[model samples]
Target: MTYTRFAIYDAPSDDALAEFGATWLGWDIRTGCATDQPDVHGLDDITMTPRKYGFHGTLKPPFRLATGTDVGGLQVAVTEMAATCAPTKSGGLALTTLGGFLALIPTGDLSGLERVAGACVRALDPFRAPQSKADLIRRRKAGLSARQETLMLRWGYPYVMEEFRFHLTLSARMPDQDRAQWFQTAQANLPPLNEIYAIDSIALCGERADGRFELIQRYALTG
Candidate 1:
């Protein structure tokens, strides 16, 4: 059995992402939905991927398990970790352009949200398996800065801790010429992000045989 660990999201349920994904990305890229598609672009298409998983920031960053790690033990640890952290009550987010693609980003005070995300990343990092040589090479293709490279070397992912940004993606990258048009369309259709969006829980997601993601468990923050 193969397993990949995700920080779990608290946004809309699996069904929601699937429905929205079909309309937004022209494909149903969520697990358990009537449709499923591969993540052909990987992190290159951050906007669409996170939205398909629903809204939530990454904490431990997803990873495939090492040969010896126990899946059950990892799940137990994740549940315990979630129980100790309190939910964030930052103001709602807004739809905006990030690196030329559409995303929903925090609008109001986000100190609390950042704190929760950082804590989760640090606490659950022990469970992350090291990146493979191919993975490392792929990450390096982004021409990471020194800090990003350092984080990648230490955490098996380039963006975390100091480099974290809370966002839900909406599309693939676009050319500069088309950016304005895309952004306008995205802004028009997206929900108003200015309201307070609560981060009450974290979800555990799993990849299905067809390469789409599915929610396996949800852990609410009790602290």
Candidate 2:
């Protein structure tokens, strides 16, 4: 299958959590197919934004491939990189509102996860095609700071490196009044969240022609 863009993600390894994500989002990225959503009020509308990408935290945002790069090379390079890194232990995950959206955020030390995300951003950057003028303009319209502009120029993305905050997004930007209702809904539907969240592997995902991202492969951090 041809993919227009690709990204790296830390997808859930736990079966129940993974299933809940797929069902709730109404897209099973692993299977590259849509799933039946749970019976919840306004669920489809709420999940529309994140449904296509499935449930995962971004390690590297989507990017077009560079002129000389190919998926085969990306796979090999990512595998090598993963083999050299150790897994990260997120003290635990908590569901909370972020920038008007609901997401699951890590509550523990972030050094290990930061290192992994940063390495992926830098090491695999050679395969990233330069951002187009329109893309840059669109991003800047969000009101970037000076440091973000610098990061954007150097890394093809601004919210990376020191700016990275790992979160598994669960909803689109909600109205102020609707936030509490959805938060309660999410908490009631989600699986147990008290267990330590481990970032032991990363998945390579490809955005299909339809704009939905599908899993390519998952590389384990064996180091």
lDDT value for model 2 = 0.92
Worst 10 residues of 2 by lDDT: 188-197
The sequence of per-residue lDDT tens digits that candidate 2 reaches over residues 180-212 is 999999999888875688999999999999999
* Model 1 misplaced regions, further than 4 Å: 1-7, 13-31, 34-56, 192-194
Q: Candidate 2 at residue 221, lDDT?
A: 93
Candidate 2 segments whose C-alpha is farther than 4 A from its true place = none
Scanning candidate 1 in windows of ten residues, the lowest lDDT window is 35-44
lDDT of each residue in 120-170, candidate 1, tens digit only: 667766767788899999999999999999999987788877787877667
**In candidate 1, which residue pairs get closer than 3 Å at backbone N, Cα or C atoms, i.e. clash?**
8-203, 47-169, 47-170, 92-195, 92-196, 92-197, 93-193
lDDT of each: 0.64, 0.92
Which candidate leads in lDDT?
Answer: 2
Q: How close is every model to the real structure, measured as TM-score? A: 0.80, 0.98
